[model samples]
Target: MKRLMFYCQHILGIGHLIRSTEIVRGLTNDFQVCFINGGEIVKGFEIPDKIELVNLPAIKTDTEFRELQVPTGFQTIDEVLEYRRDQLLTAFNRIQPDVLMIELFPFGRRRFSAELLPLLDRAKAHGTKIVCSLRDIVVTKQDQVRHEEKVCKLINRYFDLLLIHGDPAFIPLEASFSRTQDLNCNVHYTGYVVQQGVGIREQKIGNGKQAASTHLPTPLILTSVGGGRFGHDLLKCVAEASKVLETKIPHHIQLFTGPFAPDEVFEQLQTIAQHRHNLTVDRYTPNLLAYMQQADLSISMAGYNTTMNVLTTGVRSMLLPFTGNDDQEQTIRSQRLEQLGVVTLIRPSDLHPEAFADRIIECLQTSPTSMQFDLGGVKKTANLIRAIVHKQPVIV
Candidate 1:
């Protein structure tokens, strides 16, 4: 089997890492895979047991994405970068992978260029096939034209193919990266990579983590913040909204405060939720998709992964995109889906406790129309990679 080395660094939320995990899991049956995780360690987030996972000294950034910090005090940012760089290059030398799959490089994770740039050099030196695993919409930078120009330069120099995990008719690479016309690598769209849906009963429910019980409520409202670093406002709104909507809707609100949420914030939400029998709040659970499967409605940020869940599970949704750090990727995605009648978009201002409660009531009164989305991303990605490796003609 051809060896594949995958690299991903998630600074704020687990969405990127979660999406990467799905893709890597699909590839494990075919490739000798090595996954390099370059983020603050998530204690319970599980990866497949078979792949060789190299967890580098974990690094994370502030909610603003302005400052990079080491979770462990063993090294300064400069020292940690050097150590991670050496670790990555050493792994590269040992594997001499036939394929190097990078999650969101050039398009994002530009901050890790200290090590990533050199890692690319090593891969090229070894004649490895380089792939960029990107999401549907990219987070555009301030100098977008210049930003995209540099990205094109990097792609032309090293990458063999770019797998855009989205339907171009909905949102193309050109939506964010203005210089898509200038990039030299082959770009293929592999549809939306949705998390697989499984029956909640089939799961083992380990770690004292409660599954979305069959007995919870008549109509469950699932609310989640993808990574938890910046969702306090959303969660707080939902917690309060549940109280407001209790008498009106009589539905249960299940809130996931996210694993990275501030301890105080999580505690505060828990305290507020405990008084109401209709509201439940927790830190994290691996069975988010299963909950989405059972939910009557979902209220969360419009991140790629969560949106895919709404689309796949056919759940009515009210989306409030994360606007921190001036990132418009989620907003762009939510708008497109809203236009297609897949979800109702919520503004930051609309997140006021009463307004959110009213919006939830509105959503409960209405049902979302299911729109046909390209949900073949995971399978198509595997096929595309396989065809490229074997030099076989295939349609994307």
Candidate 2:
């Protein structure tokens, strides 16, 4: 079997890690996969047993993306950088993968250039086919022209293929990166990579109808913050909103604060939930989609993976995009989804509990119009990689 080494670094959110693991799951049947995770591990995040897992010196950033923090070990930033760089090079030398797949390097995660640039050069020297796995939207920098130019230069020099995990009909690369015409590598859109078979409702064979799900007796309102590194205010507001709606609306509220939520934040949410019988709060769940599949309404921050789950499940959703560090990726995505008439956008100004309860009620009462997207990203990505590794015709 052809060996493929996949590298992913998620500094702030778990969306990147979730999406990368989903893509790697599809490639295991065709390729011997070595999955490289450079972020702090989220407990209970599943990886395929067939793949070799490499956990590098885990590092992450604050919510503002200001500086890197060594979450567990006592090593300083400089030591971690040097050790991580050497570790990546040594892994590349040992595995000698036929294809090197990187997630969001030139488009995002620019701070890791110290290690990534060297690894790219070494892979180029070894004649290993290089692929870039990117999401639909990219973060905008201050100097737009200089940023795009640098990205184009690096992509053209090192990359063999750029697989964008989104549909062009919805949003293309040029929407964010204007200079798509500049890159020399082969680019393909693989639609949106979604968690397989989790959020979808099953069908019954005899009645030709959807089977009954494990839904709660009352109306279910599900809210989550991706990774829990940020978005404390959102969850807290949701808890307060539940109290406001306690007597007005007959609904059960469930909150998934994510694995990285601070201990104090989780405890506070639990305390708030203690007073309300209709409200419950938890830290993490491996099967979030299953709950989303059965939910009457979904409320959460607009991250790539969660949005994909909403799209996949066709659930009624309200999204409050994270605007930290002037990041526009989530807002851009949320706006498009709203335009499609499937989701409602929540502004920061609308976080008041009494007012937000009305917003939640409005969403629960209105059914979302069904829309279709190219959600076959995982299978298509596997096919593209197989073709690239075997020198077969590139077909998507």
Candidate 3:
């Protein structure tokens, strides 16, 4: 059997792990997949029984720069680098996999490049097929040429394949990466990777029937803003919006404050939600799909992985995208889908309590239906990985 090594590091939220889990689930049958994760986000995933996991020293990011903090109490950058280097070298020597897949390297996770460069060198020396997986977006054109030049160097030197988890027809790669066609032979568009679970058939909602009605409400409105590290504005906006719409539109609001939120904020939300018969506030829920299934509408930020999950469930959604750190990517994506009549985009600046409530009400009024794309990409990605392992040509 072909052996594959998958590497991913998630700092802000569990989006990277979520996407990686989809890929691992798809490849489990034909490959002996090993996962190397080094962050708090790793604990969030329900990894498959067949896959083996190796936990590395966890690292956290600072607000100013992508500084690495060792979980076992390291004070200096050199100490962290030396420790990670030793760990990676040992892991690579032991695994000796046929392929090595690095998630978000050469584009997003540049901080980890200190350890990754040496690992990539070792993989290349050992004849491992090196792959770099990217989500649909990267940093904006803040320093356009400089960013492109750096990425171009990495693409030319290290990666054998650039696996993009998006359809270019919807949002082209060139929109983010300059001179993308220069690396054409190595690039592959492997559609969106969505979350999966038992008894969850593709495109089927609420087990193919409406959920049982209760005294509380029928059509629920589920809302989340990733890990709640940066959702204070969003949560406040939603809370105020719910108050405005209480009398006009009767629906229960399930607000997920995310895991990283402050205890005080969560407590306050809980208290506010307690008085409102139509509102419920809680921390993260692992079974988000269950709520999405029963939800008449979803109000959420247009994070890359979150949007994909929302689209997969075919729920009428209103997206509130973050304005900083090249988050315009989400805005672009949500707008494109909005043109397709799949979702509605609500910019952060334009968001108010009343406006948000109005948008939610509008989405709830629409009929839920199937999206246009064939979501067989998970299986397709599995097949492609298998073929690559066996030295067979992939037809794009």
Q: What's the TM-score of each model vs. the native?
A: 0.95, 0.94, 0.89
Shift in Å, residue 295, candidate 2: 0.3
lDDT of each: 0.86, 0.89, 0.75
In model 3, which runs have C-alpha deviations exceeding 4 angstroms?
42-44, 63-72, 197-217, 368-371
Please give, for residues 1-396, the per-residue lDDT of candidate 1 as tens digits: 999999999988999888998998888888999999998777678888978999998888888888898667565787888889999999999998989999999888887889999999989898898999999888878887788888889999999999999998888878887777777888899999988765555321222246565544558889998889987888998988777887887677888888899899989988987678778887887878888887888999888899898888888898988887899999999998888888999887787888878878889889787778789998999988988888888666
- Give every collision pair in model 1: none
Candidate 3 residue-wise lDDT, 179-254, digit = tens = 7876633677787777774332222112122334422245778888876667677787887787888898867788
Please report the TM-score between candidate 1 and the true structure. Answer: 0.95
lDDT of 2 by residue, 133-234 (tens): 999999999999999999999999999999999999999989999999888999999999999766423322111223486444358888899899888888
| Residue runs of model 2 more than 4 Å from their true location after superposition | 71-75, 199-215
Report how far residue 23 has shifted in candidate 1, in Å.
0.5
Residue 2 lDDT, candidate 3, scale 0-100? 85
Sort the predicted structures by TM-score, highest score first: 1, 2, 3
Q: Which stretches of candidate 1 lie above 4 Å from their native place? A: 201-215
